[model samples]
Target: MKAIVHVGLKPGVLDPQGKAVADTLGRMGYDEVHSARIGKVIELDLEGVAKDKADARVKEMCEKLLANTVIESYRYELVD
Candidate 1:
């Protein structure tokens, strides 16, 4: 089984990296891109677990180590 975790700042949170990316995009003539958000994607493989169980475990991993819940939000997907 495989799990994909995406972590990012919640709405209203300050994102300096996002701002920089947006600025660069504007300079590169991407005028329609008014904003951008920087985030992380993590992929993991698990052994001997059902999809539901792996999903739960991946969520736990995000809460315990992969994500900072106070300032960040995370969503995950399970892949066979």
Candidate 2:
């Protein structure tokens, strides 16, 4: 099975990296670039797990280590 995890900062959290990129874009004449947010993607391959079990395990992984629940949110998808 293939799993994809998307991790992003929660709303109201400060994103300095994102802000810096936005500032640079404006400096480069990309004034149209209003706001930007930085996030990450994690892909995993697993074996011996059924689809339902995989979903539950992946969610646990995100909660325990994949994301900082205080400032970040994460969601994952399981694929064949």
TM-score winner: 2
What's model 1's overall lDDT?
0.93
Candidate 2 accuracy as lDDT: 0.96
lDDT of 2 by residue, 1-80 (tens): 99999999999999999999999999999999998999999999999999999999999999999999999999889989
Candidate 2 wrong stretches, greater than 4 Å: none
The RMSD of every model to the true structure, in order and in angstroms, is 1.3, 0.8
TM-score of 1: 0.88
Candidate lDDT values, in order:
0.93, 0.96
In angstroms, give how far residue 55 of model 1 lies from its true place. 2.3
